[model samples]
Target: MSGGRSAQAAIAIILAGGRGSRLGGRDKAAITLGGERLVDRAVSAARDGGALAVIVAGPAAAVPPGCIGVREEPAYGGPLAALAAALERPEAATATETLLLSCDLVDPAAVVGRLSGARWPAGADALVLRDPDGREQWLAGRYRLAPLREGVTALGAVSGLPIRQALSGLRIAWLDTAADDVADIDTPEDLDRARARSELGAD
Candidate 1:
């Protein structure tokens, strides 16, 4: 979907500033898989999915050209705070929908494609991916901008707030998908596995 009309109405917010405690505090965004940085992969996925604007909520230095970079107050404030910070940007205010993604995905393009192609259910505030094991991948979803903003507003001072708590009242639609589509790199072993999968040309 190369900037399709429907996708042009949506903006993407990538959460890339997490402190990778499991990986000895390394910068997850900078980590490479398939010879490309994770953050770069995320940017490519967002663009490929036809997002009108791509915003990376992380260190300004990690931000790639053609994408806006924002950081949550005090840094590492948590995903909800990152979302709040991104929503404050002008691009987000004008978007009809929001595509949220994290930088650690092993195959972000797969999830992005699914989200970009799926029909938004009437009356649903968000559409999230449900793994084969039935776990919701909150960040791998599409959200209606109005309800998402309202949810953020309802939770004043989102710093350090749990994402589920901030978005508790919204109506959610789930899309079931295979486990590999939702894989993320959190530890060294995970990174190794991603590299191995990449070598095998698995998506």
Candidate 2:
């Protein structure tokens, strides 16, 4: 179970429900890097990595084919709420685990493959893909459904809660990966850099 494949039947949950305020309110998922939208790239990577299901927690109108559409409460609720909404789906509860991904990943395949094939300790609640600088990309993780749901439920008022708050106290295993592989397009400058990287075929 290595090299882009996983023994667990994971469900990929792409958090595309953000307001994209940093990019002047533009839809990050719809923005094109190179020739493909970020959401499309994420969906492709999840499917390519052997995810049995792909759930996009954002605008249904923008979601690409081969993915299901779901939005969080309050229209622009944060990732926490968006994640809660995704968990309501039957697949999430039934799947062995869930792969949580932000829609703005620059190299979803590399990140997902690495995380999926990494060692998951017996008691570890989640496996986070950390950047070279050691910053945990909370969204780039694989979490056990039971632990994730327990975490989310333990913290009341999940709507509008920060992701860190939602996932606090869970035993996590971090896989330090190349920063470039986990780069996320959050601002206009980030978008430009991603485009430049894309043009150079640097993943």
Best by lDDT: 1
lDDT by residue for model 2 (1-203), tens: 24333546588899997889999999989998779899999988888777888999999866888788899888887999999889999988888788899999988988788876787777788889888777889999988788898888788777878998877678998888888888998999998998998888855
- Candidate 2: global Cα-lDDT? 0.85
Model 1, global lDDT:
0.89
Candidate 2: regions farther than 4 A off: 1-8
The models' CA-based lDDT, in order, is 0.89, 0.85
Check candidate 1 and list the clashing pairs: none
RMSD of 1: 2.0
RMSD of each: 2.0, 2.1
Local error of candidate 2 at residue 52 (angstroms): 0.7
